[model samples]
Target: MSHPDPWRTATLGNGYAASVCVTPDGDTVLWLLAHGGCIEVDDDYGCCCTDCAPHEQLNRPIPHTMRSALDRPIQPRCSRPRSDGQPCRTPVARDGLACHWHRTTKETAR
Candidate 1:
């Protein structure tokens, strides 16, 4: 089997790591190190949209040191089954202090 890359590779440690799931509308939910975890922004203006389109965007990725995987809010899209078929809480806290998973973007004016 092949190994999955944990990092999203937006800008090294300063960019969105994962491009979770995109809304039918346009909002992008990217995994960042800052903003605590998840970061919501214009779909056409974030680096976490590599899986989106190869268009020039605005926001990039913040510095890893300045990024945080906490204080964001996230919602669970699906659930998983355990060995006994028990469902466990797969918290995808995007912007809450509880879960440490959020998407981030860098500035384009830079």
Candidate 2:
């Protein structure tokens, strides 16, 4: 028997977002976390990453559209493994939380 894959949560401007694997190896997340999550194959496939694994996990596609300079808390605070068969690297975003393998975005790092 199989178990529900381990999951992780990311805090967004609205609330919490959860991400889980569906295919166990399909290279993308199943979009089980939040309502606005990107599920379309094309929309969810690309990574705004360097060390990100070939597999694409659903990322919070929402961008900070603030008209003024504001701060936001990072998500995940680290990368979690997916149910997908192969391995992947932790995600690193500009303003988001620090994952196991990524660095703070240069803008904020200063």
Candidate 3:
């Protein structure tokens, strides 16, 4: 019997959603959302629930034709200011206020 595809069945409802999908390049990724915001977690971590086993097996890569539909045109930029007092041009890390460099610097300073 063929296994069910998680990406096809994943739904957004009740202010929470989660899914495992494959990129066009064959990399598997997990997307999660809660409370109207995206939930970002470390790459090494995963859901501990027993129900995740079946969904995790569905890693069929997305088609290239679907890339544009999935891509975000406007992403949040880093909020840190440059040396000349201009806003940093780098994109912010997923669900973060600053880019990787600035985020690390800020965390180390605290």
**Best candidate (score: TM-score):** 3
Per-residue C-alpha lDDT of model 3 across residues 1-110, encoded as one tens digit per residue: 12224655366777766656455456666656445343433455444222333333345554445556678467767757666878776875444477776765644221
lDDT of 2 by residue, 22-52 (tens): 4435454533333344322323443223233
List TM-scores for all candidates, in order. 0.18, 0.19, 0.27
Best by lDDT: 3
Give candidate 3 misplaced runs (Cα > 4 Å): 1-72, 106-110
User: Per-residue lDDT for 1-110 in model 1, tens only?
Assistant: 01113453243455444444344554445433333333444444343433332232356654443344443444652233334655434475332222222123221111
1 or 3, which is superior by lDDT?
3
C-alpha local distance difference test of each model: 0.37, 0.37, 0.53
Q: Ten residues in a row with the worst lDDT in model 2?
A: 48-57
Model 3 TM-score (2 dp): 0.27
Tell me the deviation in Å of residue 2 in model 1: 27
| Superior by TM-score: candidate 1 or candidate 2 | 2
Per-candidate alpha-carbon RMSD to the true structure: 22.0, 18.4, 14.8
